[model samples]
Target chain A: MTSVFLLQWQRFRRAPLMVLSFLALTIVFVMVMAGSNPGNSMTVPTYAHPALAEQQQDEWLEQLNKSEGLQFELVEEQEARQAVLDGDTGMALQLMEDDYRLLIVADDPNRFEVESYINRTYAEELRIRQLEQQSTSGEARERVAEMLEEPALTVETQSLEGEQESFVYDGQLQMLFGMALFFSIYTIMFSLMKIVEEKKFGTWNRLILSPLDKWQVYMGHLLYSFTIGYVQIVLVLVLFKYLFNFDVGDQFGLLLLITAVYTFSIVALSMLVMGLVQSPQQLQAVVPIVATGMAMIGGAFWPIELVTNNMLLAISKVLPITYGLDALKSVAIHGRGLTELMEPIAVMLLIGVVCMGIGINLMERKR
Target chain B: MLETEELTKVFKSKAAVDGVSLYLDKGESVGLLGPNGAGKSTTISMISTLSKPTTGDVRLDGRSVVKDPGKMRKVLGVVPQEIALYEDLSAYENLQFFGRIYGLSGSRLEQAIQQALELVGLKERQKEIVKTYSGGMQRRINIAAAMMHEPELIIMDEPTVGIDPQSRSHILEMVRQLNKEKGLTVLYTSHYMEEVERLCDRVYIMDHGTIIASGTKDELKSILSGEETIWIELDRPYPELFAELAAHPEIVQAAETEKGIKLIIPKGKRILGSIFQSAERHQAQILNVNVQTPTLEDVFLHLTGRKLRD
Candidate 1:
């Protein structure tokens, strides 16, 4: 086993693409997220109607501040319209005499909430004015004001892990975590592909002919994948925390723990693919489809909260990376501890075991 | 000592190797000779523990290696038909890795690597990656990788199939030296009869998986002891006369060739008159007529009624 491990380590060290692509891909994701969001925070920017009266403008701004998690900005009416046209602002609004008009960009994840918030805010203000006018008597008007002060039915969201952060959408940090978890599977893919390579090149048969047991060869490869994944995660996280001043919460050890288990599952999945494919070239076609599809469905491309489709959310739950990335988020952003992370970690291990069993059976059948 | 008892391997309802039994004494060099797709590689793979036989057993000094081949593996070195060395690693690195897997370590592993590289004549370029080497060089390193562990038996399966003539000779010489000077037991398999004729003390000729004949050179040649083999190369085809000549009772076996015909006849110079008369009656121009003693090739032809290569 040690011999196989050392050999794989040497061989992997020679594969510069593995390390280079990991860093390059993570960097690209981080930059795209940071560049897209203002101040590199996850909050999408919002602006009130610039045509409103100055006094009403302040009121509208105040309401936006309390309505959602967006960062609200104020600008002239023409400037805001142009911003929307040029795809600068996430959403734009115009207040007409009787109703309001909103211009939304295509396929915005937050379109529904922004539209709902603006419409609700405007309708509520109009409804209050109507109530004040209709109730002319001092007692009735005072009652209307009191009722508008706070709604009788309101929800209070509580964080089970820890303190609720001011902005839940730190895009830069989420992108880092997503990409870290997403691309970590590539190592396992490459590692498992070695099985095909050995068979093609006749080395696998030679290894079998050697004195070493077959289990030793597998252990060496699995350990290599796990170790390389750990190193990649640590490298990215360290760079973000120190060099880029990216906050990764306080529970870093838990982060590593989740990543380790997640990587184990990824390696096991790659083995399953290896057992299915007959050649390294076959893996070339298979790995991208499986990895990309899983990552896309697993919400690695975007936050699950941002995914509005219930069916998609269900699929994400079934993907191993979904739990992995979630546990990572719980550690790096939510400051969650081991117990809070138990669900995802356990699910990942379960996936690991199932994939490993199936992979071993398939590989054995091929032998 | 190594022995196989009726080893058989089947794939998709057809046997690739069928009921082959062979024995090799310690310090003996044995050759397994067969054409392509004749189950030579399959037989070697089964013996090397790379393939599990469908039935029967392969034994190393009396211990069956069918179920658990650990002990047998320790004492065997296998050089596959393919260039199995790691292309991304240096020759020395490939040797070191194989050595470690064979349980060598520390200074001993280093010594093994050095000795293997020197034996393969790749000591100077040991630091270069194997992919950078020529095909023959890669094949040499492949052989070197097998020898790093110094097993009791070295099984080479068609090691010189595709290489420069110089490298082929170099490998043949190496195999001969390893067998003669070091007294290493060898199980050499090849379609090239001359290689086996020069290097192996005993030979097993296999066709379609099973061993058809096994004996010393003289003993195998004795299969055609009472017959003289004749080769006649003609300028043109003589199908009709060739077919008629094949029906001759005195001719033990007759095969028509692209050029003319080959005949195995009972030993007697007087039969030459009848052969010449038949050729003349067919109006065939015999450019050359050669009579020779039976070789391993002739023995294979006599037993299987087919050429060793075809």
Candidate 2:
């Protein structure tokens, strides 16, 4: 195993550009995902009524006019609505129920400040209206303010295993996991192409003719590819964590375990590629096409929700990347604990086993 | 000792190597001689356990290689016809990698690499990348890479192909040294008759995936006993002269060359007279005439009815 690891390290060291490329791409992905909008599902508005349009406009204009430092722009209602929908505006004001209705759009799920600000402003307006109607004293308004400032109730969710939802790296973990899965496929294809090139160059024949068993040769190549995949994941995770503050979640041990398993599965897949391909160019073309296609359908670049239910989903479930993504999202986005991810872990292990069996059989047949 | 019995290799429906049997003594250097696609490589591949024979058995030291290939693989060093080497790696690194794969390590592996490099006369340039080396140097290193394990039997398949004359001579010398000094048995394969004649103690001539002939140099030459090969050098001659020479009853075979004509004839006094009469009738001037002994090329040509090059 040490020999295999050393050989793998050597191969990785020889191809530093690949390592750098994977890391760079993962950083880019992490940044993109971290900065991206979580869409309309997570956005919460301050008010829900649809009437009182002119009253809200007059109030917003007065507030903007009194502001000394901030720039203000008042466009037509339709344009403002379009801007909010297009993720161009953060919030839009409209009239409803003889009061101001603030339409707050959160481009990021973590932007709770804007939503809270809108909610507090509406609460203050409601309190002022009540004081004017009932002649409440200043002290009573202060008390009302104190009551309104109390923290919201928090609800904790857990998986079926009774473990708390631990996935909490702010979605960076999920993005990193997805990108790592994407690059694992690429690494496996690259390694298989290298094998085919070695065979074309006749180096494989020499190695086989040596005193080493066929298993050793196969292991050496697998080790090299495994290390490549492992290092790629590690570098991407590190870069995202340090450079972009992209969270990989707090479950470091579990993340590493999943990465290692994913590496093994990719390496096994690479061996199978080597077995199936007869030429270097063929391996280059076939492995990437198959791997990238699998990744696309397996939810590497996008969520599996894009594919919905179909044969692709069924096939994607069998791929290690699908399980990796599920586990990663659980740990990173939903704050799921290790005990909650046994299913994805098991799926990944099953993929590794199946791929390795096929790969080994193919290698033996190659002989 | 290395031996193969009734070895056969079939690819799809084509038999690349038909049923063949041969043996080598503990220190003997045997050669497999044949033209391209004669199954020499296929035979060696099976012997080295790089490929399995469709039906056959290979034995090293009376132990079945087919039954226990691991044991045979440990004792056999194979230099394939293609230069099987990592061009991106330095010669030393390539040797070290192969040595490690063969389970050689530390001081033993270092010593083996040094000795192999010395044997091939590439010790000084071992640190240079193989791709940077000359074709001959690369070929020598390819052989050295195989020798790192110091196996008892070395199987070299067409090691001299595409090599320069100097490198070819160097490789042949190394083979001889390894066999004579180290007592290493060799199964050398090539189509070049001269290389086989110079290096092999015994030879097997394969054609169309089967051993057509097998014998020592003297035994193979004896097949054409009592027949003398005559060469007549002419400055310039009419095209009809060859026809005239070919029509002679005494001459068994005649071929024209740029400088001369070569003829094979039976051991009879009438052949020289008949050749002279034919040359005179064609008005050809013979500058030099010499009678020579038959070479392996002659034997191949006689058996196959085609020139060795053809």
lDDT of 1 by residue, A1-367 (tens): 8888889879877776776787678777776765675322323344445465677766766765664355556666667768777877667765543366676766676778777877786787677668777776746546766776887877877778676444366676667877887777776687667777887888887788777789998888888778887788778888887888877888777777888888888888888888898878889898889888888888777777778888988888767899988888777767878988788889989988998889978988887
Tens-digit lDDT track for model 2 on A143-225? Answer: 66677688466466777867554323333454567777887677656754666776777888876766656677767767777
* Candidate achieving the largest DockQ: 1
Q: Residue A23 of candidate 2: its Cα lDDT? A: 64
TM-score of chain B of each: 0.91, 0.89
lDDT tens digits, residue span B1-310, model 1:
8999999999999999999999999999999998888899999889988889999899998989887788878888889899997899888888988898888999999999999888888899999999999888888999998998898899999999889988888899999989999999999999999999999999999999899999999999998999889999999889977787789888887777778788889887467788889888988888999998988888888898887778
Residue A166, candidate 1: how far off, in angstroms? Answer: 15
* Number of backbone collisions per candidate: 1, 9
What is the C-alpha lDDT profile of model 2 across B96-157, one tens digit per residue?
88888777899999999999999999889988878898888899998998888888888898
- Model 1 gets an lDDT of 0.82
Per-model TM-score, in order, reads 0.83, 0.80
**Candidate 1 to truth, TM:** 0.83
Decoy 2 TM-score against native:
0.80
RMSD of each: 5.7, 6.7
Tell me the spans in candidate 2 whose CA falls farther than 4 Å from its real position. Answer: A1-8, A32-175, B228-292
